[model samples]
Target: MLGGKSVLITGAGTGIGAAAARVFCREGAAVTLVARREKELAGLTAELTGAGHRAQYVLADVRQRADVARAVAAATEAFGGLDAAFNNAGLAAMPGPMHLVDDETYDSVMDTNVRGVWHCLQYEIAAMLEGGGGAIVNNSSTAGLVATVAGSPYIAAKHAVIGLTKAAANEYGSRGIRVNAIATGATRTGMLGEYLDQDPGREPAMAGKAMVGRLAAPHEIAEAAAWLCSDRSSYITGATVPVDGGRTAR
Candidate 1:
């Protein structure tokens, strides 16, 4: 779907980000992977290139605007231009009740989950505009539509992601940029291993929430995201496509 397009993916060191990195490569896009961990990012980059895919890595903590700006510049310099971006960097805070959630928890979650995307958008949009516009997909969650099994911080941050996506879409779609979000179901990824470890018994209940009776795989969500970033979805914008395996069906 991507052909020779260049794409950037935040949090591309692991989980959904890594999965999407591979998927985009298979679809013929040169992918720029961004994350804080040098070892993980380098390892994934090597793996992709070893497989004959165009991939490279940049070290950046998306919570910081300067870091994100440098990462964007690195991607543009390496790929010539950015044709798309998956603003998917995020954090999963300790699960707890609203009243039980402390200020620190709220700040940390919002810094990475919300502000991270804000920083990414500012830079990626600039890069896209320079390249004559592109596409973006923020990693929203089912929590954005309602409550999460997590905390208020997660829900609030994801809701902000959706808001940002729609606002950007409305502002830039006319100028050839497409911005959208994915309300995703629980996925079997390293990010969710904690919950799975802490309460193995809750698995059935979590799966039951979706009509499909299972969590989505990271690659599944990647496909939905890649489609949105492709020319195939040219006419679509300002929309939240759900990849929740029917978690939001009810």
Candidate 2:
């Protein structure tokens, strides 16, 4: 569905972001992967390129505006123009009592999850504008829609992501840019593994929250993002689609 598109994927080093790189390439997009870990980024880039996919990796921390700017430029220069982007770079703070959350933890979560998206939007939108138009998918969480067992900082950051998505979508829709978000549910990513490792018993509890009674596979979430970035979802904008296995439905 994304054939001939030039796509940018933040957090492309692992989890849903890495899955997105594969999915987007399979659907025929030239993908630019961005993340902080050079090892993961380079490995994924090599894997994709070896498979004959149009893919490249850029070492970047989405929290830095200059880094995001470079990532955008790389995409446009490599693939002709930016046609779509998946703003998936985010930080997940471990769950804890609200009052016990320290300032450092709060700042870190907010900066990575919220400010990261902010920086990405600013650059991605500009690149898309120059290319005449594009689609964008921000990776929010079920926490963004409703409170869960996540830490207070994570909840707040995800909420802000949805707000940014709506604001950007409303502002840019008429200009041919479409911005939307996915309210992701529990998934089997490294982040979740870390959370579960803290308390093995929590695994089933997390999975049980979903009506499907299982955590989502990374590719499942990536598939939703891919759809949103394609022309198939042309009429969709400023909307938060829940890919949460009915967790929010309850």
Candidate 3:
């Protein structure tokens, strides 16, 4: 677990990112939370600080490189250095065949899910190297490993995340940096609301197929992410640990 370290998380206002913020703070890491919504980021910062954990919020869009640079600099100013980060900002658009997906939709998803991660890792790793090295966990998904009911665009972006994690871990491991990913299954969060609304029956049907026979809680994914960010996972890098309810077991 974290102790006296500084951690940064993208899309940290709600759902899994917010849950991970709570976990990291509990583990003793001063957390810098970032999200597109200034309102939600401010609210989360107030809540964490009120609970006596060191937390700060930066308002920026993850898809923009300049904004990401500002966010990382803000973290260094606030905490002196960064020890870890979770590149968790992403989008899940509706399901559609590859040919049917529009250019705008494709670019938007890639901009946030793939390019956003690229910016975060580039800046965060630079900061970590200056501070002697650290750990990183990117939020991938079960969709990255296997085809889901989602569109081909999302799957492609997520698969790219896994590739990035492996590449970064291999390149930086010797330098004391550890990079990994979490592939999560049917965790109930805002990301699922649209699909659930389209067909309520589909959500539970997918949940039943999981080895655990239930939807994973967001905190469950957060816990796995926290472990990856901590010294406890010192031997774990260049790997994608599933936070799924054993959905990948079969």
Query: Which candidate comes out best when scored by TM-score?
Result: 2
lDDT of 1 by residue, 1-250 (tens): 9998999999998999999999999999999999999998999999999999999998999999899999889888888999999999999885577888888889999999999999999999999999999999999999989886867899999999999999999988878899999998899888887788788777778889998999888999999999999999999898998899898887
Count clashing residue pairs per candidate. 0, 0, 0
Q: Which residue segments of model 3 deviate by more than 4 Å?
A: none
Tally clashes: model 2: 0
- Please report, in order, the local distance difference test score of every candidate based on alpha carbons: 0.91, 0.95, 0.91
Q: Judge candidate 1 against the unseen true structure and give its global Cα lDDT, from 0 to 1.
A: 0.91
For residues 32-92, what per-residue lDDT tens digits would candidate 3 score against the true structure?
Answer: 9999888878988999999999999999899999999999999999999999999998899
Give per-model TM-scores.
Answer: 0.98, 0.98, 0.98
What clash pairs does model 2 have?
A: none
- Cα error, residue 44 of model 3, in Å, equals 1.1
lDDT (C-alpha) at residue 33 in model 2: 98
- Give the candidate number with the greatest lDDT: 2
Model 2: worst 10 consecutive residues (lDDT sum): 90-99
Clashes of 1: 0
